[model samples]
Target chain A: MNGVRKAQTSPARSRFRDEDLPGYLFMAPWILGFLLFTLGPTLASLGLAFTKFDLLSPPQWIGVDNFTFMFTQDQRFWNALRVTFVYLLLEVPLKLAFALAIAMAMDKGIRGGDLYRALFYVPSLLGGSVAIAVLWRQLFQGDGVVNQVLLWLFGVQGPSWISNPETSLYTLVILAVWQFGSPMIIFLAGLRQIPAELYEAASIDGATRWKQFWRITLPLLAPVLFFNIVFQTIEAFKAFTPAFIISGGTGGPVDSTLFYTLYLYQEAFAHFRMGYASALAWVLLVIIGVCTTLSFLASKYWVFYEDER
Target chain B: MSAEAGPGQVGSEPTIVGVIARHVLLIAGSVLMLYPLLWMLASSFKPEAGIFSNLSLIPPSLNPKNYIDGWNALEVSFSRFYWNSFLIAILVVIGNVMSCSLTAYAFARLRFRGRNILFALMMMTLMLPYHVTLIPQYVLFLNIGWIDTILPLVVPKFLAVDAFFIFLMVQFFRGLPRELDEAAKIDGCGPWRIYWMIILPLSKPVLATAAIFSFLWTWNDFFGPLIYLNDISRYTVPLALRAFVDSTGTSAWGQLFAMSTLAIAPIFLFFLLFQRLIIRGVAMSGLKG
Candidate 1:
């Protein structure tokens, strides 16, 4: 529709008069996918959030009932929300701190940085796999290596961390922090963008190492730090595979590791509560959306772009 | 790469003690980082009896039994799972590279009406969480009888459902000199010819990046396979790995570890070979403009 209007409005803009046919033909698959897969399904998810639908029966529009049920009725919904926020708030900063700290250390032009980089990166590379999840379960089980180490070192017995309701979520937090290489690399790249001369100037001004870090590094790295925080927040909020695999897809041990996605999976796939799950999904979208918008808005206060303003 | 921006070396050159201390700290951190994976690898090597009791890093004997037995631990051999995952990953790579690049070509070079609006819409998808579409998509597939099959996972890739690749390729395509397109057009070449001959040939890096990530992500994907593939015979490696955890007995972690080790082999090998490219790909994505 806009093609016709644009073709009429601005014929001189196109060298060949109009690219409607060729462009549409090339983008046909994506456009079809947008309509069929993403856009269509997304709109359906919103509509379904308001109704009751099982595959057996047609959708029954019960206006705002699903939302009401979520807000007023469900215990697991509140638990899932609490768990997700805890995980997100805990992991984002923990992960980014490790990332930035290590990125700073490795950014020191250390020899064998590649080997260290590879070892550091391997976890993040393999972190999403079931193998890592399986390994995490093994490492923190009652008779696991972690307990073995604790006993061997401190002569203290550690509980089965993965199965312990009190510690299961922390294990996931540790897992999140372990895969710090991706953000660390980003921090490294961000550090690279900061001119070395800034540090040199600080040194010439008799700035201490700690002073240079605060004066020259943190402020300049704020934008990248902001990006990492925002990026990691979204990733941690959506964390499912490790939680699912480690918790054996139940988010169990009394739902301590019940990530929001895991709960949504159970609601939708396990129970086939498509409508309720849609409501849960919309809540998640809002959470992620709000967190992202807030981060962007909040960054204006704290994120110092050296070049932008 | 050698440029140092970290603030520690600020006032003076480092002393030998400081250098040694830093090296020791880094090495310690590196060991800590790799310990879990290394422990898994070691456990995979140890005999079943010693796996739990032995906290040692090295196995007493390098038993190949777990690798052999775990291969057939299930009703179907683990090779089938590998093959299923491999097949799906290859298809996903091909679909993503072809479809995303095609769409990206139009976005980068073609002056279509609604181009900017569509591009913005595509970018919007980069942040839109997939869970919002998960149930409706499941219903969509169930209605079409495509549930419980690889079609649900593999087919959307062909339609460029992953907008990230489209965006990545668009960035790379935009970097190419547009004069080349005009030159090709003057030689009686259509946009398709320019895309196939001029653009694709020059786009090997971006294409390879897209393909590698496509394969890696699909191989690592658990949710899609978990939700879609019901039969054990059709399970991907990650799904089979999860199922192994479910089915394994208390003493069978050795076998689970074995299979898990095999599951990581492709990614490990990919990292070994393409470390620079992989790291660069991640770094580039993180440094989004």
Candidate 2:
């Protein structure tokens, strides 16, 4: 298909002896951006990871010291890693499951599905803002609506989820899970793409609905499900704002909510430890890369594409 | 492998009781989702004493003082923050649309050396975490004295840094038939003329999608402004809202909630106006992602 299109465009392309000039011209801004913003910065950060530079002075060569300290000395680094991973494990699965359940429900041709969808999706739209973070902080406060409702309904007193070190990270996880609307939409789209005839045939063959689900739905939606896993995993790792907002930029309550990126921010911006921050950033890249790689490898066992047949 | 045949059809319990149960689940889920936001919206109008005292969404009596006070409560005021945010968002939208469309047109239509390889590299960057690129980019901007200004936030958009939009536009441009380009070329329309007169005119939906998304993301952005801008006066809405949190004690929850309500009002308006477009954009982008 691509080869045919390329051959067809060759005559039009050869109209100018400088055929690639137009393409090159169009790509000029991106190429410049690639150099100044992406490639240059990426390489420079990698180099800076090896040196001890503050913004105030030239970087001093520090071979493996930063890594040594991070691995051996930094308790907060481990805490950040633990906090981020815990958030990821809880948030991603719960979000995906909730989204999938809702997506499945929406697919049933319920009354006013669009209105229901609109209602469900508003949180994902507004979830990223500081406003929502502030609202979350308020809601999870000791005297906030959550506790109020718990007392009113269950007659049980609730702890201040946002401030208590035991439960602070869980509040952020809950916040992340609430914004399942995007994945829900994706799952809905994937569900819609499945031909209706298959279900019709399955039902005609005396296959029970439960059997149909376990035997059909889960595997067919695997690609979309896998995409959501990878996408939301990356997002959860990069999550900083809510933690920042709720913890008041301190990642406080004894660093229970110290997100990896927030810690990196404190290192780079707060402390001006440029070299250390660069090392931290490189470590983040590796973590994300590892997560992505692991997902893809696991996907080989379950994820199926249409063309594979 | 038989799971590939039929994806979930809501597990189709078509009985009346089943339908009612599903509706109950959905409505309950949506209410659970929207309660916090609606509660915040309702609480924004309440006085400080009434905010937490009443678990109900309704205020005892409507009050606009929170809105009034919150607007001026911050050192720089919410109005200035709104203006700053709008300025940055508008510039970002224009820059992203222009640069991403240009880059996308090149990839979608024109045949060039290393085009395939370059396209692959661009796609790979879609997954490349911004953290890796952030530190050096920050240092670069600091060295160029772009820090504490909107330049660090606004300048990158103009350079087509958003590769996802480029991928999106490429998908769109590929869907346009080659017949029009052929006719334009037959009339001696060169690549530029063909791109401008033929392709772009037929490409409104993709362009609109890109624009709306660019506008929305820039408007809601927190990290970029948090890192780059220093002064409260230059702060965007998100930063300003954070400042309200920092400056005020518990006496000001009313004012904080009020400004927070106002901060998300524009986004809520945008969602109301362009809900379908925005949802479709999310699905489209998610597929690409």
Candidate 3:
């Protein structure tokens, strides 16, 4: 058997080692796909930033014109940036706090914990979809569930959440916060990793429950907390479906829920400003990258990796 | 090993004030989480006029006809939409599992030239906001004539386009014992055999994790289907629901809610059936890694 196998393999073995080939062979499809799809598109998007392509005509070589328009004269660009920043600032912190609080509660050996976790997670899974956004619009509409409940409970009228300019943005913010499950699950996992002995030691040392949580739990869970915050922050900045559906694909009632991605999408697909949208896409990438980097830099002071210190 | 083993033995019953506060907070939070769903169910039974009348958690009377009407009103078959989503989600899950796990296995265990750089590049893909590549991706799909079909939705996953899943699988693979591989090699098994017979079996927990997440994300995905699938017949549930609402100008709230409930039901059923796997998967995929 060995002689026969050797005879069969000798020709190919002389040409190339099988072990060396398998890994590359296994990886070849992925590598090829990434190059053709992601890598090429990334480079093209960057190049398109310098052109004036709109899909209807050949891309004109209008060097720096898109970026120039975006920076020097675009009111809507600034508006989108303003809207997205305000959203990130409010939504990220609120979402983290809500998830952390719920995770802490979940960690306390609460009864029906799994049910609660599943319940909280449902909204997160639903929030990213256009259907949920439609549901949200209905719930917050003038004659929707929210208003009905408000009227029933308090005998007061409620505003049209998707249409009212003053409150429309806040409605989307609430939608963002409602999808806190992913982060909460992370927090719960982080909480589980905090050894019971540390809490015992703290309690034995006369620390109150809150104090133990503040000192032992908070410090130890910092790495996980940091991860949740960074991930949620990026996600919040990418908020699109809710805004798009709620705003009726126009980014109005007065662009109140005009998230950055939604605006970029409009530029690309709606108005066929592919080149200019490409520029906006690049700018958004830089913005997100900078935010993520800043989060990592700030983590040095707070996020407590086990071996890093 | 369990809650019974823990040291929370302070069994003193709380005072009335504490009891009220705790119950109030707990109930309030639970209501906040459950209210929308409850209202959705109730609204689906409410008459068109009753929809915005009381804003109450309870409807005055049930209108079962709304569901019948909603089903009949869709220009395209709703069952076809469900089939589209279901088929695409299954394909995505299977593709993601095989391709992502293979790529992740290579990254996690194999030592090769430029391995670290390639891994870093994969990680960098996660940081690149998806919208940046979405337009170009759309154009590419258009050029390939795959835009009008479900190919755009499922094929990329087969190519391991999802860096997040790859990262997740890499983390899971890293935590596994190296002895498993060595044992397989000593038994004269090749890498593929080891991966198939040993690593894959041991990876059930994380594989379930990847599968459940992929299923949920794929099922809930609207933007990809919305962009590529211009044909109404090819629309997924989310896209179909959007179309349903758009056609009516102000959709019959009761029927719309019913349809929304139907759209959400499959996922809810999935969560119920595999609750344990999902919880474990969510835990493993989180920062505890």
**Per-residue alpha-carbon lDDT of candidate 2 for residues A175-285, written as tens digits (9 for 90 to 100):** 999999999999988887877677777877878767877777888888899999999999998998999999999998999999999999999999999999999999999
Candidate 2 has which clashing residue pairs, if any?
A216-B3
The best-first sequence of candidates by TM-score reads 1, 2, 3
Could you tell me every candidate's TM-score relative to the true structure?
A: 0.95, 0.95, 0.92
Task: Name the runs in model 3 displaced over 4 angstroms.
Answer: A1-18, B1-24, B54-63
DockQ of 3: 0.42
True-contact fraction per candidate equals 0.75, 0.70, 0.43
Tens digits of per-residue lDDT for model 2, B24-97: 88889888888888888889888888889787788877889999999998767777999999999999999999
The TM-score of chain B in candidate 2 is 0.94
Q: Order of candidates by DockQ, top first?
A: 1, 2, 3
lDDT of 1 by residue, B1-289 (tens): 1122333575345566555655777799989998788888888988887877777778878888989999898898998999999999999999999999999999999987899999999999989999999988998899899988899998999999999889888989999999999888667788899999999999998899999899889999988999999999999999998888888846698899999999999998988888888888888887754
Residue-level error in angstroms, candidate 2, position A185: 0.3
Candidate 2 positional error at A100, Å:
0.2
Report the lDDT tens digits of candidate 3 across residue range B105-143: 878766555667888888888877877777788888887
Model 1 / residue B125 / CA error / Å: 0.5
Candidate 2: Cα lDDT at A280: 93
State the weakest 10-residue window (summed lDDT) of model 1 chain A: A1-10
Off by over 4 Å in 1: A1-12, B1-8, B11-13
User: Across residues A219-281, which tens digit of lDDT does each residue of candidate 1 receive?
Assistant: 888887887887788888888999998888889899998888999999888888888899888
